[model samples]
Target chain A: MKQSLFEIVSNIQIAENVFKMVLSGDTEAVKKPGQFVNIKIEDGGLFLRRPISVCDCENAGGSGKGTLTIIYKVVGKGTEKMSRMKSGTLDILSGLGNGYDTSLSGEKPLLIGGGVGVPPLYMLAKKLISEGKKVSVILGFNKKSEIFFEDEFKRLGASVKTVTVDGSYGLRGYVTDAMPKDAEGKDGYTYFYTCGPEPMLKAVYKASKTAGQFSFEERMGCGFGACMGCSCRTITGSKRICKEGPVMEKEEILWED
Target chain B: MGRLSVDLCGIELENPIIPASGTFGYGYEFAELYDINILGTFSFKGTTKEERFGNPTPRIAECTAGMINAVGLQNPGVEKVISEELPKLSRCFNKKVMANVSGFSVDDYAYTCERLDSCDQIGWFEVNVSCPNVHGGGMSFGTDPNAAADVTKAVKRVTKKPVIMKLSPNVTDIVSIAKACEDSGADGISLINTLLGMRIDLRTKKPVIANKMGGFSGRAIFPVALRMVYQVSDAVKIPVIGMGGVSSAEDVIEMMLAGASAVEIGAANLVEPYICRDIIEKLPEIMDKYKIDTLKGIIGGAK
Candidate 1:
């Protein structure tokens, strides 16, 4: 992992309390799709850095120079301060947490995400499609007002479907409710990848027909894995969500009932 | 040179800034960012006799100027640490590293320390009797003077390396525990480990950390650390390694002045990944500002 100063190109409110921030910095550390960046807030009293996943990254100025995009919600004081920031340098710890393992994706892969979790899967879907893999995406949000990145996901050439809890948009109910059933005679959706809240993740884990990968969210410290603050018990053993994974295989995760 | 070198027990450190255990994972992780050989030495993650899975999720809680963590002692155990972790650490760091050992029992402490002593790269055995995350072990051995001395004596009997008993700050009288360890043949002392603290989620009306409480550390705990270091260093003749909420070069000098031979940086490293390196580079400038030429000259100077 590397720490560098990122210049905030823009911070815009896309949804109700959600924001989309584009940053310019050394993006070399971000190798995988689900990897995150730990942002250090320069406020008076906040000492801990806030962890946010990489929404997208591209080499902007040249081969070594690039810009990173991240989506965050104004959950507390840190993000509230972040929402007000227009243009400034942010001290960012890049290439944090083990990202999604795209190599495990089969020919036909299904991607599922909810709310803020939708951003990481956008990059994942893009990478999977680039590899000549057929990709399908399911986006879940509370309502139409909270919906975001639907066109962004569709622009990447993946078949996108959105689900809302209030029936205010397409395919009302949760993402799990919109999950496609297994076809009888053919190998449908050889593998699945999902990122969302704990309930959604657990539902996806139970509803998935094939071997899949699940991304977990936990309150973290030192997002690079120094502090064992985000550890979760798995079938193998306890794994740090920041180190071993923000992503884990379906078989390895032991969900608490 | 402004005499940055420090003698902890018999081992010499290039500087007094050692990254506290659990914050610097086996040294190799941080070495990927910078040349870790520039450090005095770092204490690797807390290890135990058996591989521990550590506590459950939501183990961290952020505070005003600090963070609380109940990471427990998540490690690959002593055998794996010796066979796997240390070899990777040796590749990046050429200096003698400190081994931080935690256990559930006196024999557990002795067994783990004795095994770690065989590693040539290990300079000192930092017995962690002050971890608050674990239930039956860790802080249980540290909270009481007799238990702290018992663990210290047990580990000292099994190993020939310098033994520094890491003390917890959650106690009423931390000096008594430090003296007890020193009286039981502890080569040195390191304090204060994270203070026990907690936070509640107002919406859910529940504790933020799954463990309900965790050890709190950061800039907020610096004064508490300095006071404990002063009290403990005065009470014991053994070299004291002061820590807790130490983030800057000035804090390092102040800790040394308060009677610490060395200081460990914990939560600050989490906030700024390059903090230790930055502090090391800034130490001389801070030393010049304070009109101090030698760091060792300031040890216990405040006392």
Candidate 2:
């Protein structure tokens, strides 16, 4: 419930309609692997809030205060306006949604994401690396132009693999295809963490050599649980993607019907 | 000091902020995140007799300063709501929660009312009559004056609880609709639900939402809501709960001045979870700066 004026530290358009924005704010509240922040792009009436994934939370960078970094794609009016914003403070509501559970990530951890879904993987990759665990990322995009942050994931000290629909990239196929095939059926990875479109998630769920975590995306009214705009069925029952999780264990995830 | 108490149908709301129905789900979900008893009463989701699955996929579409939704009255039926949801909601807030109910036929309205009659936890009942997504329910009974009165009469016969008729803006004459509800024994009126809107994808050349048409709610619809509330308040005798595109504290004051006794924030809640609380706190400061004493005197005051 902490609202602060987050100055835009940096913004980079990784791909068309896809941008990565870094805002300087109190990054303490948001301290999870798969959490989010609700950003109001326009100052005027009806600044329709958009939910962006927490890319990184910097505390001791230059000043010890803190800075919240969010990564999002320009989907609609809010995101489009957010792209035009340059080095100004925007009212940000951070520490939203139940983030990823890192305790579950075992010795060998694998992360998979498609397009904008790749943002949360960066945070999870950092968390996994800090714990002295082996981390691997299989990044997927429609084409080479849509691919982003391939080298960033590598910098986290994890094995990063890139895949593209067109043959202009590394694996030149789906992330599931790019998965370490030699390690399949060898109990190589304890858990699998993934985020992307419903189709991509379904494919990852199908291709996984082991059970772990999967996140779902839905049309959200409130990024919090108030609106009930984002709900997905799980093994237990109907759970809110924003509240219960935007990231859930693979065992708990009830794939799209 | 800020005047936090507001009377909706002679029932005092601790604060003026009432969470719009369909937005707040029985009050338990948000109660876990924050204190529910902090500011005001929360209006539970719309309930009918039979359970509904709501509209098909792509029910919502983003607009310029707002959104359009076709959520077709998805609920667990009135019986389950009274027996289940009410018990859960009582643990969250001590305030008498407002029940936002909907029905299809004349019998549906009466049946739903009868179920909620003995529930002391519910102080007021808002009959939602402006849902454009429902075929024979929402706007069907709203547009016609006779149909509006008939539903009001049916509900009044069953429940001693105060009834507030939520009127839709998708009508030719809103004044007539407001007057009809009051004449038939409604205790209050909630004006200006979403306006009928449609958006098309230029590239695909198809409707943006799965359902070609949807109900638009957001800051873009505020002016129309204000005008309708002004007209209805002048025409009717009951209290009016105004809504539609209310995002900020200033918008709440504008709705109150335009004729609303208490404003229900719809799209604004969709934008920010804490926005209603934000507006409620800032309201008094606005009132003090304007040199206003009571909120009652400002209703229908142009300028």
Could you say which candidate leads in DockQ?
1
| lDDT per residue as tens, model 1, B1-303 | 337989999888889989999999898878887899989899999999999878776789999999999888889899999999999988999999999999999999999999988899999999999999999999999999999999999998998999999999999999999999999999999999999999999889999988899999999999999999999999999999999999889999999999999999999988888899999999989999989989989999998
What is every candidate's C-alpha DockQ against the true complex, given to 2 decimals?
Answer: 0.81, 0.38
What tens digits encode model 1's per-residue C-alpha lDDT throughout A1-257?
Answer: 77889999999999989999999999878889998889999997887899998889885223477999999988988999999999989999888888889899988899999999898998888889999998989999999999999999888899888999998999989998878788223536889999999999999988888898988888999988788888888898878888999999999998865
Q: Which stretches in model 1 have alpha-carbon errors above 4 Å? A: A60-62, A183-188
User: How far is A231's C-alpha from truth in model 1 (Å)?
Assistant: 1.7
lDDT of 2 by residue, B1-303 (tens): 236566789887766678788877788876765687865676788889887767654567778788887777778788889889899888878888888888889899889878888899988989988888889787899999999999999999998889999999988899999899999999999978888999897878999777788888888999999999889988887899988888887888888888888888887776666677778778889889888776766877774
DockQ of 1: 0.81
Pick out the ten consecutive residues of candidate 1 chain A with the lowest summed lDDT: A179-188
Q: Candidate 2, TM-score vs. the true structure?
A: 0.90
Docking model 1 quality class: high
**Which candidate has the top score in lDDT?**
1
